[model samples]
Target: MDAPALDLPFDAEAMLPGLRRWVECESPTFDAVAVGRMMEVAARDLALMGARIETVPGRMGYGPCVRASFPHPRAGAEPGVLVMGHLDTVHPTGTLPALPWRREGDRLYGPGVYDMKGGNWIAVEAIRQLQRAGVATKRPVTVLLTSDEEVGSPSTRDLIEAEAARHAVVLVPEPARPDGGVVTGRYAIARFNLRATGRPSHAGARLADGRSAIREMCRQVVAIEAMTTDAATYSVGVIRGGQWVNCVATHCDAESLSMAKRQADLDEAVERMLALRSATDGVSLEVQRGVTRPVWEPDGKVMALYETARGIARSIGFDITSQSSGGGSDGNFTGAMGIPTLDGLGVQGAGGHTLEEHLLVSSLVPRAKLMAGLLQVA
Candidate 1:
């Protein structure tokens, strides 16, 4: 039997104005006020689409989260679809001057434009298009916009899990892969904070009397990175030490991250990282565990959901492939819980978390139509 026809006039050019507004609002993860403002903008848009808007208060020093629910004829009879995306970005608030919004060929460049404000906007626009066509979906839809995804969703993990528990399926519009693919599975990730303490003394006059914490930290960094294997990898991205050049450093701090393809491998990697000790005689090393995202290996149900999306994309004149990613997103929580999840359903471009972040302008309409189709059936 032929499926019901859906007539949606999704215009890429018409989408630019709304997307540009979202991209220009800089909401870095650490800045709570900025994130709240971004939420206001999204709340208004969601309200315009006849969704019940709820602004959940932020906890743990983060900003608020916006939950928008669309009413349905069978609202409580079954679980609904959860469309997830994060509003917080990695770039700071003052990044507009250097990386302002501009159109060059097909790429639309701006802060948070591609790495995910564009994707979130696209999802909302999809629902609006469906409403304009007067099409009712099989299930109800809810949109959850979070505040802290760039730093592993520390403040929002519990809320994300709680929300996902009530949903039948999850769709994460994080950035689409460079080849316009989707993500079925994501690797496990763990973060650690490292501190080294030692005695302080003059560098020139009493060099032997003092133990340099900076030197000890450097040694530990090298050893930690050397622990990488075929299944796991480690990197120390941030380091700070030494108040003065002439005096031996008393303390040094660093942050490191680990990633693995499997849960067992990541567990082993975490154990190895926590077991690190100071090789220096008078220096003490401390390792504290931080936020972690467990591995989300796709199951049969996840694959089935992907197949549905693939069929929808095929009808839209574009085909999408699925892959496993090393990066972590909110989908990790839901997918790990054995729920059917489809991720990486976002805008197409490149340079996330960098100055060249952008999305392809030509991809807007097709991707929006794809998302609209999914909302209609899946």
Candidate 2:
């Protein structure tokens, strides 16, 4: 069945109001109540453009995943392109004052504006444009928005992979680089927690009898830090233990960050971590977590998708460039599934996860137009 052609006018500026509203609403990870409100707004906006919206349940106290779709014009065509983004931000309920839309010349300041509430709006506007122009795409279209991305997408990773496998290509609307280049490759992230145990004793009286868990932890930390090489990086981020100044610490826990360029590096790191035994005979060790996201290498299929995206950008008078990043995203999950994924298709800005996070207002319209054009061509 041919879907009805849409002729709705899509103004990039027209999306700013809604985008700012979304940014102002604090939808932090696992805040199911707040996230539900945000999803309601998105579903309303998408419905106006003739989209069917459904919420995919999530586990582990994560926000819901939304799937909005517009059927293809012709029956028995190829599957659709999936325009993906997330609704969650790193900010809690009120980490900083929720900055509304502020235009200082050509920049818009707000939380998750560029890092990616703005990107979601861009995708919606693009689809609206294609429908309004009466363009009959050869495939169906789906936009999957998750609410757990800022927190590593613990719950929606499976849903994302499934959607990506069903699509022709996955376009991630993460914020572009400050230089306006798209991202073609992203690193995998593996976050782990390490714990050590020791007997407690009075520091002044029985210091010799008590084994220091902190000391054992320090040895393991030094060993892990030493494993960092050019291809991979590791950091002992947090350490917490000890009861009193005059007492030998009975327990110590530490968290580490591990990055790898390839899967083998991750496996080696995990093996090393699991092999960690207490340096002191009296102490014990535990490895709590392991690899979270796999590395995303851009193979030939991914490169071809990027080439097509670059052509779409060129048609809209935007010269797009690609680069590799050590940071991970949902794109990493999709790319690891052997699906062609391209990221950084949103506004270009910097200061992510900080107070200064802002988006270039000038880039918003052009990028939106480019994305809209890509949907038309795809």
lDDT of 2 by residue, 105-223 (tens): 77788777878888888878777767777776656788898988876787788888888888888888898877788888887778888889999999999999999899999999999
The TM-score values for the models, in the order shown, are: 0.97, 0.87
Each candidate: what lDDT?
0.92, 0.80
Whose TM-score is greatest here? 1
The regions of model 1 sitting more than 4 angstroms off are 1-6
List, residue by residue over 1-378, the lDDT tens digit for candidate 1.
014323588888889999888888889999999999999999999998899999999989999999999989888789999999999999999999999999999999999998899999889989998888788787899999999999999999999999999999999988898899999999999999999999999999999999999999999999999989898999999999999999999999999999999999999999999999999999999999999999999999999888988888888788999999988999999999998999999999999999999999987887787788888888
CA error at residue 108 for candidate 2, angstroms = 2.1
Give the deviation of candidate 2 from the true structure as CA RMSD. 3.7
Clashing residue pairs found in predicted model 1: none
> Lowest-scoring 10 consecutive residues by lDDT in candidate 2?
1-10
